[model samples]
Target: MAAAARASARARPLAHPNPGVAALLVKDGCVIARGWTQEGGRPHAEAVALAGLGDGGAEGATLYVTLEPCAHQSARGPACTDLVIAAGPARVVIGQLDPDPRTAGEGAERIRRAGIAVTVLDDANARASLSGYFTRAEFSRPHVTLKLAMSLDGCIAMADGSSQWITGEAARAHVHAQRARHDAILVGGATWRADKPRLDVRLDGLEARSPVRVLLSRGVAPDGVRVINRPSQIGDLEGVQYLYVEGGAVAAASFLAEDLVDELHIYRAPILIGEGRRGLADIGLTNLADAHGRWRASEQRQLGSDTFSAYLRSR
Candidate 1:
């Protein structure tokens, strides 16, 4: 179970919209097959593992899957539950149950009905690995994370939009790490025009994991830039598991208005920019009370002269 869970973690930031799931078939202390959720939602984890099985490899084998095989059928393929049953694995160990209304516990139930011994291990590691996927499946929305770098007074840039190097090297490096963990990074057209950021992860020894660069422009974005006009555009990204909203005020306001932000990462520098650009765009919350209980702080840390805090949406 631990090995399977670790493998699943590797697929994070890569699989989005689709659950980052990994599966392994082990029998008699030897590994038989291994697979993870592939791109574009085709060849699900179960199917990939089963494909590795040659000559009916599932017979008398134990299948370890990260999440309960999906029970619902879609245009992409048949229900994963049916595939597992037909493959005929002797026993199935699931990390967590699917929470989507169409599946919920149905996938596991189907496997049991097929006479395959099934076990659901709700361990902390497994649960954490699938957190983003389960959040989306249960809530019908993307797992959102807001990334902001500001001065002590909460200014993001200068009054004339000269916002560069607000944080130190350490803080900037940390931001790249955050990018590496997400499937996509989004910014508004205003920011794109002003900064022209590469928006790709750049830590040494780490593969250049570039989150799909997205421009939140209502119309055509700048030349050579990837753009999405509406909130609905997110659904088309397919397997984006984690979305990072890097903002200029207007773009942040748009997402907030849509109630699309799921998490927040705020980095505060030691200096203040009293007459600089505002920290955040107007989100149009009725009042501070209206914002109450919508989010919970998840983490807080200090790096050099900067402070980083993370918040998860309460809902």
Candidate 2:
């Protein structure tokens, strides 16, 4: 189920309006086939996996799926629940329940009605794969990751405001990789004017993966970037599943103030710029204890001379 969920994330921004799903069919203690949701969200994960079976793949195999196979019929495609029933899997292990009102628990219910055993796993990692969809459904905004490249002491730049190369080459490359996956990259007007950042992905063969560039500013719009005057307008960005907020402190803080940030990606170089701008502006926490359970780190690692970590906001 974990592997199936991981595979689902590959669909990303293209899978807008639908959660990318993945499916794996196993029998005799071996995987018969595995597949993920395709581009444009067609040929759903279950269909792909079912088609991959050479012979006798689903008769008694167990199906592991990232999401409950959709139960509601749609003109878009046949209901996944129908397909799974036809395939006759012996059992199904689901990573998470589909949140769609039309299909929520019906997929599993239908499978059980067919005498196929069903199990739902308690897995946080699997749930994270569809965070974008959940964020949009629950918050009416894209899943936002506030990314900061700062000094070990929490400074983003020198007091003079030059912030080039806070993290090393490896960390920069990783950031580029993130850009390739997200649907949009956003920054404040100050960062835009000072950096002239070509928020495009530069990785080989993925140059086209450059996300839509957005500027969070009330000032003059920069050439070639979509401009939103206020943070609240972020919810109006159509089809943006994942929004990467690359920042100057003010823009980063604005999202935090609105409690719109879903996650945090911090890259800390092993250096200090004690007098520089901080990574974020004050978020108006009246008491230190007020911020205790807002976020929890989910990942930490080393990137050359930089320490990188990711934090997801608690529900």
Candidate 3:
């Protein structure tokens, strides 16, 4: 299941309008076929895996899938549940159930009725891989990730307002990778005007993956940038499943205050800058206790001279 979940990354963000999914055909403790959702979401993971086999490759094999096979038929293609039924896998292990109302639980029921064994697990990794799809389905908005790069003393800039290169090259590269996974990247009006950042992915082969540039402001947006007056306006960004918020203090605080951020990515450098600009302004929290259970650390890693930590909203 974990391997199937990891395989979903190959199709994520590229499979917008459809949940990125992966499937593996295993027999006698060996994988016979592997496939992920194709670009533009055609042919689904199950179909792709089944098609990869020479002939009857799925017969008596156990199929592991990150999400349940979609049962609804579409003009684009046949129903995935129908494809799986025809492939005739002996057993099906689903990491997570489909959240879409049209297919929810029905896909598994259809497969089970065909005399196939079905196992559905409440897998965290599978759910995490589909976070953007799940968020949009449940909340009518993108999954928000707020990113902040600061110093040991939690400062984002020097006393003179010079904030260039807070972290090393590796950390910057890491940030770019994160940007590529999101559908759009946003910054506060102050940061947009002060830094004039291009906000585009610079990685060698990933230039095309650069997300849409967005500015958080009431004023007119620049030539190519999109604008949103308030964080809630993120819901209006049609087709944007994931939003990466790179911010100035005010913007970060605004999103945090409204509890709009779903994930936090922090990069801390080795140096300290006392009496400098803080990483974030007040987030409307009067009591520290209220903040204690709001976030839970999910990842911590070292990148060059900086350390990166990720936290997920506890709720």
Per-prediction TM-score to the true structure, in the order listed: 0.74, 0.94, 0.97
Best by TM-score: 3
Candidate 3 lDDT (Cα, 0 to 1): 0.92
lDDT of 1 by residue, 37-117 (tens): 776556788889899777678999999998889999898888989999999989999988887779889999989998999
For model 1 the TM-score comes to 0.74
Give the whole-model CA lDDT for all candidates, comma-separated: 0.83, 0.87, 0.92
Candidate number of the best lDDT: 3
lDDT at position 240, candidate 2: 87
Query: Which residue pairs clash in candidate 3?
Result: none
Error of 1 at 208 (Å): 4.2
- After superposing candidate 2 on the true structure, give the runs of residues whose Cα lies further than 4 Å from its correct spot: 220-224
lDDT of 2 by residue, 240-284 (tens): 879999988999999998888989999999997888889999777
Q: Output the lDDT of residue 4, model 1.
A: 82
Q: Candidate 2: global Cα-lDDT?
A: 0.87
- For model 3, state the Cα shift of residue 156 in Å: 0.8
Which regions of candidate 1 fall more than 4 Å away from where they truly are? 1-7, 23-64, 70-95, 99-106, 114-128, 131-141, 205-208, 230-233, 236-239
Backbone collision tally, model 2: 0
lDDT of 2 at 24: 88
The model with the greater lDDT, 1 or 2, is: 2
